[model samples]
Target: MSMAAPAFNLRTDLDAMWLLPSLKPRIANQLAGLVNTAPAWMKNERPLVSFSFDDVAKSAAHSGARLLAEHGATGTFYVSGSLVGTHSDYWINADRDDIVELIRSGHEIGCHTHGHLSIANATPERIFAETRTNTRFLRTLEPDLKIDNFAYPFGRASPGLKKRLATRFHSSRSTRAEVNHGRIDLQLLSAFPLMDRKMTPRVIDRILDRAVQTNGWAIFYTNDVALQPSPYGCSPALLAYALTAAEARGIECAPIRDALLKIGAERTF
Candidate 1:
């Protein structure tokens, strides 16, 4: 990494191009290519950076997951039980075979929810039920693995609900973008949400330099990859920028959960 890289200005909001019919596949491939070129050591490290996608969508199956496999990078897919087979959700095209393929590809399978809901309104018991049900269903798919990772639907959770989730799940996520504090709160893990093509290469370079300066972890969450008609996917050019930025900095990119795991569990206060 060189000092020549400029300061990056971070922003929220996915690109609107994902909603378009064309340019989807191309962008998807770029996402795959980004992952396919990753370094090996970063794939297994303490405080490593990795990619994860929430809400099973076609872009996840066709674009995002593909790109992750290309780079030999593994991501955790948190899917809602109800949406697994439904064809109606924005990008949750539960390709049964693809879901199996993702598992076979060495990716982690986590739960999003039985149905998408914000824990803001639900009681702690309700939150626990939601997470438990999804995890139970996911177990049928892969009996040997433990369901450790969870993402709060809509990034909503209360303190009480957080406690319940922490007791049951290893980690949870929200839209907050920063490095993990190396803790296991299971409620407020920082995440960078992906929307259309707003995240560009130049933008990614800026973030990596900042993270290096701070020595903090950054985890990016996306709904899908380069699938067409995307209202929340980044383009290939942009996806590669972020991935390459990590590579350029000599920082290995890895799955978010694995990164923290290598650091050991965070103590509960």
Candidate 2:
């Protein structure tokens, strides 16, 4: 049977010019620092790493999943349910079947707001509604799916939104460029990007080495995964390098939910 077309527009508007202004993100970053929702008490014996994809693109659904699987690791894909099967100028977004397959293959599916709206700019009601809508859509694919992890759209979240996200998920990740270590905020867990322009092999190696040295958790985020990737995306080769680096350092690679479990942040799966 053919699936019904999405009730909303399918295009993504992630461009800096289209979303929040430059100064707003800076302000959001500052606000995030002030909020304390869920504090992660770190007791990690070894370094942990999670390779996650936000606003997952189809290439990530395939190549990203494959790369992780090749290394006997899995990833967490933070999906905007409304964008399933959609196409934007920069990405071919993952569809419903891809999400199902991801779960079947042992990848975690985390939540991004349905409209991909920035948590920093949205009202509480809007934030709740969008997240509810996203989970509702995902439930159609896997009725038993438990979305215990979240990512702020555009890596922006207000203080109030941070509190709300903390209450709703086991952990919520932000696009902050650092590793989560001793006494970190679970609500705004730090994640560095794996984009070509932002990270190289040496940078990845350094980060992995640091995580191992500190016995911390490093979460890497990205969008699409292809040989020729989008401007904000990481190439497959870079993704593989990250996985290899983590493995070489004896760092355990897991999805966000599993990593949280390892750190004693228990959630009902």
Candidate 3:
């Protein structure tokens, strides 16, 4: 199946984007972790876990929020202001009303850039520019909204860019698959997908078990939720199942914003 093309043209270098193009940012991410860290003093607490939905697909706005709320938890929605109410290569984006509903229902709104631009594909100037546009656009939707978190588009960020983001948001999430534990870097908090392409129930169960054993933080991200989801998304049933399993394990489920507070990191904005 052909993917739906994004409305805006991507300006990434096609040559540098070959064979694990994300590796460039991944390396920079590792280096950034060494310096300019927002250390989380996550001690004497139950294992923490957060569910985040990127792009805020229509299905995610509906089924994703419903499932989390049913479990008495809320997921973070990392939105691209420019993509709202549009059809993407994956799924139809969430509309303005859905954004309002999510805020009203207690879900978080994190920045994902104005046009969902991949950090690997954008220059430092464009990165800052896009970030500003994303925040400004989201505020236009609701004047008093507080966006204190961000997710790197395509799970990529340069060292310089990561340093800049660290001062701006409470936390910046990445797509690296690792459990966050003991003196972790808040700027590039690690997370992995819950989609079929990357994970299975048994795999997620083990991830939850590890978090429980270590008193660590397990952050999982996804895109859409429906009977048929995109490659970057999971089915509604899988989402519900993951939540149920986490709850069954007695994991403390909270949105990224709330979970950060519990670990002794305060939102700067």
Candidate 4:
């Protein structure tokens, strides 16, 4: 008898994100050392690790917030204004005040465009509307909300796109978390996707040490932390390990927007 073919074959550890204790502690120590030894100009007023959560998933409310809160750290949640009030399963389930509470606590609320998409395929008008319209919606929800921070929808940035958004946004974040040593490109800042499960703490520390040595701003993005986390999320164990390591050192976590703003006022990309 012949067997039927499988309908689908899923991948295992394809993303290569995981949390390793030894590596994380090393990174934590290295970061603290760099902060203590770095030159005055390079050293930010506050030693900051910017934890940013994308898509504003429901898990973020727990995993992201709890870990940061445990260490008295502040994080940034970049929400898509259009997702609000929509009963879409793909979108998170939370109200305006829920978001407001996150802000009211110690976190910062930032914009992630109206719809998360790539600029490579988006038209100029669409880009402006997505960036500008959502900011308006965020403001309408909370009259005093300040739309200072922003990030590219799909980690893709173009010079032309940067020029368009320069006047409207203060700082823009991206997924290129190597280091920010050279001229800081507001439109093309760097970040590491902490939620990628296969990632090792050693790998994370390697990246962190390099970034801290250069006095570069390192922004880590995530959505959840669980053993069977989503494709773009981390496990709770890993999240705790990383946070513990970070805490051992003097590295305090701050929302991405506040981190930049604390360093200095925003500038054009």
Candidate 5:
């Protein structure tokens, strides 16, 4: 039997405008960062970078993944099961075949909840159910898949949800726009956006440079990578530019799982 469609529409409901310069969300996110932290010490000799795609758009699964592969790198694709194979106003979601191809091609399949709901607005029960449904659906496609990473939908999180997720995932990423270094909160790992509308070569250089200087982990996240990308997505050229910049700096690019292993991230709860 096919899974039922989620009531929320990703095209409309996923907008994070409320998170911009808002005192409430800003305070909430800051407060969440202070508590329920699963701290990890990052120990590595060289800088590390990871490219991750949230929601697994068709272009991301194809063009974005291809670009990474061309660079001899792999990325983490955070999949929301309900959106798989569905069409949004901006782009189409990756189907079962695309996901299978990603797995076969050695990409990491991360979690983004089943309905793409923001954890800040979800009840505890709803959060559990969403994760369970998403994991179950993902395993149906690849029974042996090990989904150990998660990205909060819309980059929203709370202390309770963060605590709950820490038990289930090896690491959870956020849209905090910073590089991970030293002592990091694994429950809310900081990540920068690679949006076409907002990113520039200078900005990419600055972020990568900081990672190299600090010997840190730089996790860059984007959605669809196409010629004309959505506001939240980046163009193929921009994606390639970031990858090439990272490579030129002698940074090692890998999926989140592999990067974590290489960096020797150890949890200190």
Candidate 6:
């Protein structure tokens, strides 16, 4: 099924906003990278790759998860409880059944907070409430579900949020584009985009090659996988190409939780 085309180019709008004269957003992101770091040592013996979906659009829950399973792989789906079964402007969010099925099918379900609020400036109390609400909602669907990891909504976070989340989650991913290598920040892992407009065969090859060269963890994130996708999503063909390329390169594809355990990543507190 074709996704509705967005009213405006999402990427272009984002770029324009980020390029504003103040450059505050860029500066804040840089600061986020440097501060509130919960360091972890990655003693990986091989390259690792993790495919994740943020806000988990319906297509991603169905098509994206199916593709990963077909490749003998599983992905992490970061879900916001409030967004579940809701229709957004670009795509529909995954429903409760999708969440249950994901867990049943061996995929990881990470927290994206209850309201999908950006925690960049949220108070600790608010952050706690949001996460707790989300946990409770998810557990309602699957009693044994353990939401271990988290991803920042809109890829925005503050030092205080990171510090607080560190205590609650094993790891938290940001939208920072890079291959995580050597000493890493468990609270703020970097991830590359798997969006339709951003990823290409050559780009995928380069990313995989870098991960192989550094024996690093490469996490690719997107929202949906459909023939026609939102700006933040990718086509199924693109997703397949990525999975196939990773397999060819002998990269071990895993969910974030498994990857962390495999790498023996211990908190440096």
TM-score of each: 0.75, 0.89, 0.88, 0.76, 0.89, 0.88
Model 4's alpha-carbon lDDT is 0.65
Output the TM-score of candidate 1: 0.75
Model 1 ranges off by over 4 Å: 1-47, 181-186, 227-229, 266-269
**Better model by TM-score, 3 or 4?**
3
State the lDDT of candidate 2 residue by residue for 1-269, as single tens digits: 99998675434533453366666656766878886667768877779999999888999999999999999999999999878999978999998899999999999999999988884467756886788999999999999998988898888867777777766788888988998888888888899999998899998988888898789999999999988889889999999999988998899998998888788764422
Model 1's number of clashes is: 18
91-187: candidate 3 lDDT, tens digit per residue: 9999999999999998999999898886567765687688889989998888999999999888876677776777678899988898888777788
Quantify all predictions' global Cα lDDT against the true fold.
0.62, 0.86, 0.85, 0.65, 0.89, 0.89
| Candidate 2 TM-score, true structure as reference | 0.89
RMSD (Cα, Å) for all candidates, in order, is: 15.2, 11.3, 9.1, 12.5, 10.3, 10.7
lDDT tens digits, residue span 1-269, model 1: 65777655343223556434345433442342233121121222423556777778766766676666666677778888777777754555666667777787788777787776654345568767887788777777777766677787766645555566666666667665666543323346666765555565565666667656655466777775763546666654445556666766766666656765554545332
Return the clash pairs for model 5, or none.
Answer: none
Name the 10 consecutive residues with the lowest summed lDDT in model 6.
Answer: 20-29
Candidate 4: tens digits of C-alpha lDDT, residues 34-130: 3211112233654456778776766676667877788778788888876654444433544576677776776788778887655545654677788
1-269: candidate 5 lDDT, tens digit per residue: 99998787765654555444454455566788788478778887889999999998999999999999999999999999999999978889999999999999999999999999874566546875788899999999999999989999989877777888877888889998999999888889889999988899999999999999999999999999989999989999999999999999999998998888887876432
Clashing residue pairs in all predictions, respectively, total 18, 0, 1, 12, 0, 0
Model 6's C-alpha root-mean-square deviation from the true structure amounts to: 10.7
